[model samples]
Target: MFIFVGCAGGGTSSMFCQRIAKAINATDPNLTATFGGVNEVLADPIACIGDHDLMFAYGSIDVVRGYSAFDFGQLFDAILVAPQVKYLTVTKQKIMANYPTIVEDIPSEIFGKMNGEVAFEELRGELIMLDLLRGYQSSLQTASKNADKDIEILVLNADHRNQQLAKVFANWQRYGIRVLTETYTLEGLYQFDPPADFELRLLFGATMQLNQQDFVRISRRIDGLIVFSETPKTAFRDWRQQLDDADIPTAILDARMLEKRADVTQLSAKLTDFIQTVEFQAEATAGQIRLPKLQTKKAKKQHTLFGIISWNSTIK
Candidate 1:
């Protein structure tokens, strides 16, 4: 077994997994499978090809103990981390990720608007995520010829910065990743009218506060796999019973509830293929780096992490 994790344009990755499942199933009938491994891994893609199991999860397995979805290198034959711009790194550990998404998400809108009053203790900056991705992509583009491996780009942004975002896209082209043309959307946000309230006026920007809950509530809608057996006493057993009977590993990824955001998928496949396969040289990808925005803080958390930056994924 092999495990690869990262921020992939859901479209291509989804199709890729489906196609892989098809090809794999053709080789053997008993191999169970499932698709859609997000920041975390999962059980299976198809219903009945093999046992349901997850090959990845949140956090470094070696650094932090106690996890059901880990120890892939020990249990499986190979390990892969197809991370987006940035992911935490624990050296000497077999586990890895495509990118590092801080399991944390606080609204930037609050810090920007705060009516200039909300005191935010220097948590982190927008560039922290973006810069890592840019450097990661730049490093990878410098290494591989496949272009598929080098397209790993990542970023974070203010809701109103789409104008500046145009400039961001332009910069990526300079790096060879060309995210605007390569990336695909993971999640698309729904528009909702903000509720009228006075507290929002003081705590956060009216535009953000009004719509925050709407975004958070939408989190329950995830693409998890389960089934019913239509049984007697309990009404029915889950269809995954076969997988359970086989004792296959499983991991659930709840991506529905993150910061309110949207997806962008209107990109060319030629670009997507190029971006996914890029990588960096051992010497360059070996050390640590910092984001410009963190310059003010003399004491900043500097830990080696994995990252990728592709423009086409989150633009919507």
Candidate 2:
């Protein structure tokens, strides 16, 4: 079987490609895995994923839409950080049914830091599970050609590798909230995926230089938007205003939030509440503007949450 993985820059996807390729080659050398960037695959799908058995694309919904135009046997958005139980169980059953030989025993010490043979075996299991889950989801949605996402959130962060931000995104996924940022890292890839009727895509503004048309396209689709900036006062005010003018739900967060899990958790909760509610009136508090608390969902949602978190950077 051929596995093709594509991400915005191809860095994260390439690493996963290499790991899965190494594991698969140990047992079945005939199987192959490859990686490419968003532009490369869109420029030439046949050259990047020719004769592919399955394809996984991780990025914004636009990236997924561009890829869905092709005729891959199975295409997965690869956005679910933590999926529901039934879907995960079905994924495992399919893998066991098809590739029982690749399965290995789990070590008793699977909870914490592991090393030596235990680490090796555990990593192997993880690769197999991820590989199978991608393919299984693709097969389930083979009939549909459209990218059916219930909610799409755009995140702008200075560092894509921020551990606190990573945990926040994972928690949001655990609660069935999908996200989008500018770019992704290996650590991010390890903790992400999307479910049917739900999706997550990352587009970090600090890394990816988005043009006017790019912003226009993205602005129309996103349900909620949050930005984490080191210098929010100077860097994000104008752009934030532009989004606010367009009536897009936008929030400007202090980059220091990336330093603590609790802060990020509070930010995530605010975003989640914003996504579910229908209206919001911005309020400022404690040198940090809270986005919006939960209003009622009975009426249509108006993208009006304009929040900003600014304070002395030295506090961090």
Candidate 3:
């Protein structure tokens, strides 16, 4: 079997892809795995058609929604239209279970002030679109009197990754790195806030250049620094010199290198646990599927999900 994995660019998807390859290989040694960014695959679906038996797409609902355009939607529609794709897997809930500390740190308000269940349903809607596409494909195939391909849509609950990541965040003093970037592309790294025990910060190159005082302030706060390969050395010369003068630990690595060293290793250890914890269920098309018809009840708001529960308000 041939499998394709896609996600938003940056290391999360790539790291997950590695773990997936290892897992799939362990189970069925004959299967082949291929990986690419979701946008790249969507942009060129023709090249992918008939080339793979399964496709796994990863990302937040926002990431998936960003790809929804007249033509782009058509591209995704084509995937289901073709008989080559036998299975499609995507997430239906937050990767990590909710924990009190995580809830307090990340703030559900960012997700439109939603309760965990509502937020999950909102995210799951994106995947429902995929289910609908598959249903449409099934209908067409049945209409033609062709043997229906048992196309399975696997909705993965990835709360374990979140739970494990919370552990990582809780122990950020050991795993956290102060990353310097030139743009907001790296903001995704901070989606989950780190614990207060570590001084986790992102310094924009231009901002530092314009405000030396702020640069100096942040530099002193950091005990170590990591710069991606794409960082302009000349622009950061003074900052690097300051780091050297302060005798701080520093390493310069390619963007991909940073992801592997900092993210993949920490996350891979949690994959087995993630796989073991995953719960799967079939879902109906978008219109037919109804959000849980329950009244939004007010209760004491506490950050708790998966296994990360906050006992106190203090993050440390």
lDDT of 3 at 18: 45
lDDT of the structure predicted as candidate 2: 0.41
lDDT of 2 by residue, 148-255 (tens): 334445566556567776776788778776555545332232222443334555545542543453554354344456677677676665566657655566666667
Model 3 steric clash pairs: 95-158, 95-159, 96-162, 98-304, 98-305, 99-303, 99-304, 99-305, 100-303, 100-304
Candidate 1 on 1-316: residue-level lDDT in tens? 2223222334433443454444434443433334444333322212221243222222222222112122231222122222331243332121223222222222434222323112112212332453354345434422111112221222211221343334434554566533322121222111112133211110101212213223211211111111111222342134235323322212221222122342322222222332232222212333222111110101112342112221211100
Instruction: Please report, as a residue range, the 10-residue window in candidate 3 with the lowest summed lDDT.
Output: 96-105
TM-score versus the correct structure, for each prediction = 0.20, 0.34, 0.23
Best by TM-score: 2
- State candidate 3's TM-score: 0.23
Q: Model 1 scores what on Cα lDDT?
A: 0.26
- Once model 2 is optimally superposed onto the true structure by TM-score, how far is the C-alpha of residue 113 displaced, in angstroms? 70
lDDT of 3 by residue, 1-316 (tens): 1112222343444444445434433443333334455555544543532333233333322343211321222233212111111121222112111111010111123233224344333423433444444344434432110121111111111222234434443454355432222222222222233333222333333222324433332322222344444553543465566555544445443344224235655453442233223111111221121221211111121333112221111100
lDDT of each: 0.26, 0.41, 0.30
Model 2 Cα displacement at 101 (Å)?
48
Q: Which candidate is the best by lDDT?
A: 2
Worst 10 residues of 1 by lDDT: 290-299
List the candidates ranked by lDDT, beginning with the highest: 2, 3, 1
Candidate 3: which stretches are off by over 4 Å?
1-10, 29-31, 48-50, 57-61, 66-133, 136-316
